[model samples]
Target: MNAPFGARGTALVLPQPYLLFLGDTTEPGFAKTAFGLRDWAGDKCVGEFALPGATVTTHLARMTPAQAYAEGARGLVIGVANPGGMIPPAWRKSLVEALEAGLDIVSGMHVRLGDIPELAEAAALLGRRLIDIRVPPAEIPVANGRKRSGKRLLTVGTDCALGKKYTALGLARAFRQRGVDADFRATGQTGIMIAGGGMPMDAVVSDFEAGAAELLSPDAAPDHWDVIEGQGSLMHPAFAAVSLGLLHGSQPDVFVVCHEPGRTEMLGTAGYKLTSVEEVVELTILLGRRTNKAIRCGGFSYNTSALGAEAAIALMARESDRLGLPVADPMRGGAAFDALVASCLA
Candidate 1:
C-alpha cells in the first residue's frame, strides 16, 4: 500500500511541484505515469515537458526544464513506460537539462537511473537525486498468514492497466469522506509515485511477493480500511504468480472486480481472450478463501473513460443487475458510486 502524496518515506522523498516528462511517447497507455500523476496527485505537479514529436499530453502547462525549475519544481519525473521500460537515448538530453536546471530525476522505468551514463553523470555532477520507484526493499519478511485486524478491500483486475489503482484511490477517498479511516495501498510503480510509498509487487522475488504485500498493508484499527491497488490479473497467463501472491498476502475481507468494458482480449498478449467478470469473481473467491474464509466481492469497477457518459452508466447498471452487485465508474461519482461505497461498508 502507499501513503498520501508528498508523504515522507525514509527511503525516498519525492519533492513536490514536479515537472512530468512525457518524452517521445505517443501512446496514452505508455504515458500512464504522467496521467496517473495528473489524475491523482495534480497538486504536486507543476507542468509537463515532452519531446517535439510526442502527441500524448497530461494537459498540464507545457514547460522547458529550466522553466519548470524556475517555477519551483524540484524534480522531473520520467512519465512514460515503453515496452522494455528502458530509457531511450533520445530522452537523455532533456533529463540532463533538468538536472542542470537543479531538478532531481525520478523514474518508474525498469532500468535504474544510475545505470545510464548521461543521467548518472549529470545527477552526480549536479548533486541531484535519481529516484527509482520500482525497486523493492532489501528485506521483506515471509508472510506468516496470520489474520490481521483491519478491514481491507482489494481491487482485482480483469486485465493489466484497467482500473485497479483508480478504483482503490476513489474508494479510499469515499470511505474517508464518510468518516471512515482509510488508506490507499498501492502495489505498482505508478501507484507508488502517486501515493508516495509502496512495495513493487512485481519487482519482489517470487518467494517474497506475499511478504511484501503483507508489509504493504499492516494491521490497523478494526474499523479502518486499506483500499489496496492490485497488480496483474489472476487469469493473466504471464503474470498470475504476482497476482496470486498478492491475493494470498492481502487476504482481503472484500474485493471489487476492475475491468475495462469492450476489451475482448488481454493486453500485451496475442490470442488470449479476456476472462469473464463472473470467472474473475468466482476464481478470486475460490483462491482468496485460503487466507480469509469470509473473503467476498464487494462490487465491480469499470474503466468507463473511453465510453460516453450515458452509455457508461447504462453498462454499469446492466452488469450490476446481472451480477447482483453494486457497479460504478468511481471517476463518475454519483448515486451509483455512492451505492458502491455503501455496499463495501455493508
Candidate 2:
C-alpha cells in the first residue's frame, strides 16, 4: 500500500488488518475511530475488540484479542479517545494478550503506550511495535496568512463530539456524487486515520495548530472545495484554543455548523448547557470572518443519534425551519447533505 503523508510530510504506512479496541467509551468521540476505520479501511479492519462490560455500537461484533489475532489482525488499535489518552488499567490484560499474540499496537492517545512498563516489556520481549499517532511533528511552521485559491467549507461544532468530521466527510462524498472535485481535510486522529492523511490539530503546539490546517488544504482551483474538518467548540473551555486556530488557519469561504440535537450538556462536562444552534452559527461566522470577511454559514449537520426515528425526523425539520438552512444527519446518508453541498457551492 502507498504510504499516507504525515503532518511533517513523512510517510506513514501501518500494518494491515487491524483490530480496533473500543473499550468502555462507546460514545461518539471514542467510537469514532472504529467508524472511521470501517469506512476508510474497509477489508483492512479485521475485527473490533471491546471491554466485556462495555456497550457496543450496533452492527459491531466484540471479539477477544486472541480471536482477533487468529482472524488475521496484524495490529491492535486503541481507538478510543479517553481523557488524557491514558490506557485504563482494566484494558492492560487485553493489550498484553494482543502483544503476546505478536500484534503491533497503534494508539492515537496523548499517553504513549510505550511508556507503560508492562506493555513496553511485552512489546520488547515479543518484538512487536508501539505507535502513537498523537505525537506532533518534529517541526511545524507558523501560519503566514497567505491566501489560497479554491472554495473552502469548514465544519464547526457546538462541542467536541458533535460530528464535525462526519459532516465534512459526508459533504465531500456528496460533492463527489455531483461531479464536483472536493477533498475532506481531516483535523483529528480519527479523521486522519480515515482520510489516510491530515494533521491531528489538538496534538500540535498552539502556534502551529492553524498552520497544520493550512498545510492540509493547500491552494486548488477555484471550483474545488476543501471540506475541512473542524476541531473543538468556541465555548468548550478546554479545547477552544484549538478550534480558534483551525478557523483562522483554514480561512474558509463558507462554513457549516454541527450540533447534537437535545444534547443538554457538553460531553464529559455536566451542568454545562449547550449553546443554541443559532448562537453557534453566529459564533462560527463571527470567528471565521476574522480571517475571511466574506465567510458565510453554509448550513447545519445535526447528530440525531440520541433521538429515535420519529424524534430525529421532527428535530431535523424543526431545526431546518428554525435556522432556515439545510440540516442533515450526515452519517445516515440523508439527501439534506446534498442540499448542504449545494448551499456551499452557491
Largest lDDT belongs to which candidate?
1
Would you estimate the TM-scores of all the predictions?
Answer: 0.89, 0.80
CA-lDDT, candidates in order: 0.88, 0.79
lDDT (Cα, tens digit) per residue for candidate 2, span 227-327? 88998898887889999999988999988888987677887775778888788878878888877889999888889888787778777877788889988
Report the C-alpha lDDT of model 1 over 153-187, residue by residue, as the tens digit.
99998899888989999999899899999988888
Global local distance difference test of model 1: 0.88
Supply the global lDDT for candidate 2: 0.79
Of candidate 2, the 10-residue stretch with the lowest lDDT total is 1-10
Q: What is the TM-score (0 to 1) of candidate 1? A: 0.89
